[model samples]
Target: MFTHVDAIAGQLGRGLLLTLAMTALAFTGAVAVGLVVAVLRICPVAPLRAFGAGYVTVFRNIPLLVLLVLFVFGLPDLGLLYPLFATVSTAMALYWAAFVCEVVRSGVRAVPRGQAEAARALGLGFGQCLRHVILPQAVRPMVQPLGSIFIGCALSTSLAAAVGVAELTGQAEFLTLRYDQPLTSFALTTVVYVALTLTSGLVAGRVERKVAVVR
Candidate 1:
């Protein structure tokens, strides 16, 4: 029973690598996309703001599983044949990007209006004001909330298994079927997920504390 774990140890390692790869790539992409959405949502232009708001509302409402399926199948029909890994990572990034935009929006809002006014009074344009004065302060308050978002993004990678990315959960399923030890296989999968999540939370917590402002 327990020996089945040893039989597929190499597969387990590869599965973990895939899961981590998805999480890392997706989170990085989400942050970049989400930051742009946040800026668009808050910018002075009405149309841009509307576009940003609509994007967040639509993507946030869609199910992750649906996005994964769409990326894998729908994109191919549209003449774009993204690989399984690319499709899954892009889907997860888009899904998480909506939420990350909201988190970042709140952070941007936390900045004092006076800062932007000061920057503008100094003859700086809107972009300069945001870059030099507003964003520096806004980013400070966003540490904790964004940490939670990061953990959520990390766990969301599990859904990639549905599209055959063969991440951690997928490996367990394959192993269980091959070895006929459902309980042992899945039990280990649960532990691995828990460990990954806990480690992520810890790292985020440390980084948050490091950047936290006392005032």
Candidate 2:
């Protein structure tokens, strides 16, 4: 019984690494796409704002499983073949980007209106003001929210297992089936996930405290 744990340890270790890789890649992509979408949502141009809102609405409303299935199976038919890892990571990124965009937009809006006015009075262009003034202030409040988003993104990487990415969840399931010890297999998996999230939360809390605005 316990021997199965030892036997599957190496495979599970690899799966854990893959999960981390997927989380890092997907979260990075999410942040990049989210920043762009957030900017568009707040742009002076109406069309850009509409497009951004549409993007967030579409992605956030779709279930991750549905989106992953569609991309993994459907895209291949269109001659857009990608590696399983790439496809899963991209889908996860697109899905989480909407939430990230909202978090960023809220952070930006939290800055005082007078701040923008002051920047304008100082002859700063809109972009310059946003980059040099608004964003700096906005980032402080956003740290905790962004951290939560990162944790959520990390957890969502498990969904990639449905498409056979062989991440942590997939490996856990494999061990369960192979050993017929669901409790042992899943309990260990749960511990690993819990440890990961708890560690992330602690780091985020530390970072938040470090960057906290004194005001």
Error of 2 at 104 (Å): 0.5
What's the TM-score of every candidate structure? 0.93, 0.97
- Where does candidate 1 clash, by residue pair? none
Query: lDDT per model, in order?
Result: 0.85, 0.90
lDDT for each residue of candidate 2 in 32-92, tens digit (9 for 90 to 100): 9999999999989999999999999999999999999999999999999999899999999
List ranges where model 2 is wrong by over 4 Å: none
Instruction: Tell me the spans in candidate 1 whose CA falls farther than 4 Å from its real position.
Output: none
Among residues 3 or more apart in sequence or in different chains, the pairs in candidate 2 whose N, CA or C atoms overlap within 3 Å are none
Residue-level error in angstroms, candidate 2, position 91: 0.6
